[model samples]
Target: MAVVTRTEPPPRPPRRRRLLYRLRVLRHDPTAALGLILVVLLAYLVVAPLFAVLSDAFRLQYGDEVHAGQQPGEWTGYYLWRVFRSQISRLLFWEPLVNTLVVAVGTTLFALALGGGMAWLVTRTNVPGRRWLAGALVVPYMLPSWTFSLAWLTLFKNERAAGQAGFLQAQGIRTPDWLAYGPLPIVITLGLHYYPFVLLLVGNALRRIDVQLEDSARILGAPRRTVVRRIVIPLMLPALSSAVLLVVGRVLGTFGTPYVLGLPADYRVLSTGLFQSIRDRSTGVASVLATVIVIIGIVIVFTDMRLMREQRRFVTVGGKGAMDRVSDLRRWRWPACALGMAVFAVSVLVPVLTLLLSTVTRIPLNLSTFTLDFWIAEELPGAVGFPHGVLRGPELWEAAWNSLRIVGLASLICAVAGLLVGYVVVRGTAPRIAAFLRQVSFLPYLIPGIAFAAASLSLFAVARGPVPALYGTTFLLILVMAVTHLPYSSRSGIAAMMQLGREPEEAAQIAGASWWQRMRRIIFPIQKGALVTGIVLPFISGLKELSIVVMLTTTGTQLLTTLSIGLVDYGYTQLANGVVLMIALLSFTMTYLTQRLTRSSLASGLGG
Candidate 1:
């Protein structure tokens, strides 16, 4: 037996040696190695910036040191005291927190009511033009979220805020404070922009529900209401909950709608408050507000996870023949169709028409005020940034090219990286590494875009170790855009990869193929559709993105979004509206062409 113990295999290798051995294992199976690399990279990109934000929250920031009676860079509790306990705490924190909750809750409720009804009508009822309605209703979401807010301001803006009176005021109608700006308009604007999320989610879930369950309940003499209350509602809870979480998350992080609508009424939400803090160079206060938003987002995500875990045992799908039975509305069919059309018109056509009308009219909503100066005039003497019409200026084309170059490249990187993350998560052998990569990549989605921008500014504003100062650089803009929009691409990748089998890669391996070779020759071809969807969605989103780019873009690196905001700042309303319309057209065209080329739909991407 040779002493029977064999000296325990030389006491095993040390921990370091074991790690090296694991690294060496990549020669045979590289998935774990790749997963670990992604985990580390994402941790640095996502978690490091957040750490910088948290550190700023506690440190004595510049300009704040004078107020706090502390030296800059010193540790202090002054920010906490000012934000939570001082006399202005209510104005700074409590009021904004309360308003944030009000807006978030209100928007969630309104969106649910509108979206749930539309989803039910489109997916469950025999509503005429269901096909068209389903496609048309999602167009609002495809546009920028703040488009509605801009349109609202165009129609109802009073002289309370700045610039000039809106169309209604110009027409001699007096718009009340509460109606013109505050929770009412903010809620409506957000609801219209975000309802498509609910519609898509609930509609998909509804389509998947086994109609046999309802049929059986009906055959058992259960009344329609009883069956709905007991079975249908319970089955739809998961989808509804998901939609609510999405709406709530969006509302929490939204800056443009609330800022545009809430400013005049002095209705400050958390995001706008954070924006003000940043703009005022109150880095400490901004950090604290950003931290609060991140915590709230974490709570929402955890709550959703808990609910999902509890509902894991409830299976809506079963081993039975299921069919989509369209409910016969007979006499109500035309009314239902009209209702669907009304939703589409309000959500899509109205805001767009409002903006279009504004761009052509010197005074919005005035037919006699129409002109083409904003679109094609060679020169405008008094214009600041745009001395010529928007289409005639080099600025518009430059910004558009920057947008296409920066966002296109970022989206491409995001798509490829997302697919790799999916591959590692689904096919990797190390469970912990896979889990870390998945979670860290999604961390950016939880943080508000403004907060992430703040973090990026803090982290990369100067050189840190190997990474040189990236502030005011195109690289920084691309990096932030890719990281912020990564969630969409990663989700699409994960869903697609989970459905893919390992057999193809295994066969390639049997033929002595390397990991890169297998991915290029086999996996890439299989997941190409998902790759395109991942890229296109982010491109559309980044094209209209304002919040993240607003903070990161400099004069030299201006994007379409920043240009539009600049025009608005300069009071060039018509030029601003023209740029926004261009963005909408670009986004819509890309979405349409991508769907046509790939034969995949936005619903599929979103539902996944």
Candidate 2:
């Protein structure tokens, strides 16, 4: 009847009908839009680079021109063949691959031994100094990998490659080649630095174990060791696997330790080899190496993920987990405490002390010879800006200020963007946007630090499109850092915002609170801790970072980490040590202050 009328209904309005359907779907499924958006963005960021890097790997190139023989932009397997299977692949890929596996396995074992024992001492035993041990155990994980690498070099560099006398030499000790450098030193250093990761994971798991399980096992006629083997070990497998994943990822992508300790001895792991290839402008080979690293990392991560995903329960019959009585070590308590302190002194304090001592000592990296003149004296004759005068020197201050400026700005950008990304992922009405935001947020996690830096360098090196000469800009550093740290920050923000819940915000909306007002009052205040962690974690991590910023800058924009690295290159071990110490101190200060504040806020938030 209506259609028969002169003003017939507008042609069924298909477009408007479809639009209305989508809106109805969105109303039915609000959070999914956000999830889809996050997933897409994350997929592009993580997977795009792999494709781009892979494409770069296959396409033949020499300077601006593609090679004459092959099709201009056609894909080829030349890179894979040349890097992985050629006669020279041994030097470029095979040996390095072997070295990486060896170091990784060795480090894994060492870390488990150290961390498991420490966990046992604190969790299951009346080990003296357990209170103090917990704090010290996490120190290594907190510091950057290279800090320990540099510390190892400062303490053990022999007269072979650099011929730089180290701390041992200063005390009239002739360290063997093995002690100074090689796979042994590399693995030990990496292990010591990473064991704390395992300690935390394993300790947390162990502490949460229900004592009643063991008691039940005992009641079932199971012996102590049997109870542990059948029950505890199985329970802890998930946490242990997670720890293994972390340490493996850490060692696999690391460039600094391998570079610092292995390179001088002609030892080439994947990172050092990849770095060398890039340095030689062998981008094809570097890409191949990076691809290899990525593949290995992905495999390990997926394995860990698969294991984690399949697990039904981390706890059995969850209760307020009982605290098991500590095993009395009898007379071994005091001695055990002493040993723990000694290890702490050497592992944590010694490296820091060495750096401070070296900074004061004029010889810098070559610590065998010492001079207070570097600290007290105004200037050295040939040194560019050195002697203790340089401590107060404008260049040093400028470098410090520049680092803070870039790092601060980068962290701020990351924090804000991360918060938005989190909110969108958690609260957006669009499914695609949600997935995209999540995927993009997780990209930096998959990329190796150096590779990511190189990626930035590659894309931005050429002045094209909207990017104008970002290759040397400090803004580039800020952008790169923010991007690199985005994955973690954004994740933290999302997790925080998720806990804010929909009810309160919904209530606010029904009460007619504006969007901004609801966000300012209800959402932000409730989830501030996670936001703080996002900011603080990135800021602290950026402070100790060298590998990312190293490939992206010149001496003019050198970071403290870069300076420590350069001091190594220049054979100024002591001054390098000082720079390292300063960086560590800065990190420690920030960590303590932020942790205190976080604790305070959480207490306040809960109390309120």
Candidate 3:
């Protein structure tokens, strides 16, 4: 070798120094700085409470002496053991665990059956009202999950559950115990509510499928059933899993349905049990249940996601433009229309009609009775024995106030934070770290409401080194709402950022402008509409969120969603209905506002 050993080139200063310089520039970059600030703020709001909850579970409280003097702050498996191994274990854990599984499985099956069938019928066969039914089916999904629960109670509640009759009772039918409560009702309600998820997901899948494949099989003498079984189902696996997972995640943390149906039968699911544990001031048991719920959610979600990714292979196979739809059956059109209408009636009209009926009734169960007392009664000091009526009450106002403020604040937090996070993720130079943060933040999405709540509970229980306890504070509510709503926010944020290209910012930088100069002058203005929509969405979702925050706090600190549950629990049906009405109105109004504010921008951003 030639003695001319070239000295190795000195390594450039570590990226850390470069990173600091970049960060300094970012501080000046309004867009970049905005994103970074949001991440920290969100971390504080969302992550801090989680740590507080975790610490609370592990640390000792007033009743530490009850467990034979097991000191507080001492590590013990007592809570876990009690939940899993104690004498009342079945009531606390086993029984509800089964109920959870049954409800989850039932929800998944119903969603698939109803959704998949409709998807197939409309997309492949001569199904009547395919176009109309396709859109109508999505309406229930558009409404919050509890919307159905309220509607279910409004219609099916009998003397056993509500102490008042339902719409059925008014029509001279004693709704059977089976129809009135427990697993069947829970499953039916959740399924009906979520089936639209399946319809949309599977319908999209069906719309992409090639008709030629089916025709080819038929031309080869393959039977209709054979082609469907061999080709359609397999092709549907990905979309099917997506729908299943969505429904499963939804049903897992579902507090409203079980609360409406199961509580009367004394049927317990994890969500209800978690609520009970919290009410009794049993933080440890509640957190543990929350964790298990999260675990179940994770497993289902993991499977669902894997299948979703696997779906990428089923791209539009043919070069032809649009996929063909199943033509309407001319002769059987009436029958097909009837079937579709029946489902639509049950899922949409019936539940809402039931709510309308209940609002005007004095008693929920008995027939041959009617009154508008709940809505317009001015002087029934003892009506429903509540503190107020539907139109007026300190409590009602307080709840409405709480829901609006919290949901509004939380939504704003999520939207702004999500936009920043998304921007950072899409635009950051440190690609790996950005991706890591994005995914980690989204880990909560894979988490079920109960589980994510448990994580927050477990994460925040202790005061830790710097973060303080937040167990019973309003801050905890804000934290959980923000975290639970992160997935939605981030999705919108990332999409919006992607749409707002780098060229404008680059032009600013190229003109000797600092990063902040460009962001203030260029980036934010262009993306403001999209960002606002992101913020607004989380608010909408948070306003109606029930399961995740359900066990996290108690009365006075409760959100409207939780308050509704409490009212129902205390036999305050009218008050609960009032709470629901308030939520629906707020949600609808906000959605309408969002539409008006971003009609043009959103349509462009969404490529509609």
Q: Which prediction has the highest TM-score against the true structure?
A: 1
lDDT of 1 by residue, 111-189 (tens): 9999999988988888888887888888898898888988888888887866656899999997888888999999999
**Candidate 3 off by > 4 Å:** 1-62, 65-69, 125-129, 167-173, 363-370, 457-474, 512-514, 552-558, 592-608
lDDT winner = 1
Q: Which stretches of candidate 1 lie over 4 Å from their true place?
A: 1-33, 211-224, 317-323, 498-503, 506-512, 603-608
Better of 1 and 2 by TM-score: 1
Q: Report how far residue 277 has shifted in candidate 1, in Å.
A: 0.8
Each prediction's TM-score against the native?
Answer: 0.91, 0.87, 0.87
Question: Which has the better TM-score: candidate 1, or candidate 3?
Answer: 1
Task: Order the candidates by lDDT, highest first.
Answer: 1, 2, 3
True lDDT of residue 180, candidate 1:
87
Task: At residue 45, give the lDDT of candidate 3.
Answer: 49
| Predicted candidate 2 versus true structure: per-residue lDDT over 498-522, tens digit per residue | 7777998888877867666877797
Backbone clash count for every predicted candidate, in the order shown: 0, 43, 31
Error of 3 at 389 (Å): 2.1
> Could you tell me the lDDT of residue 100 within candidate 2?
91
Candidate 2 deviant stretches above 4 angstroms: 1-48, 63-68, 71-74, 170-172, 219-221, 318-321, 361-370, 381-392, 503-522, 600-608
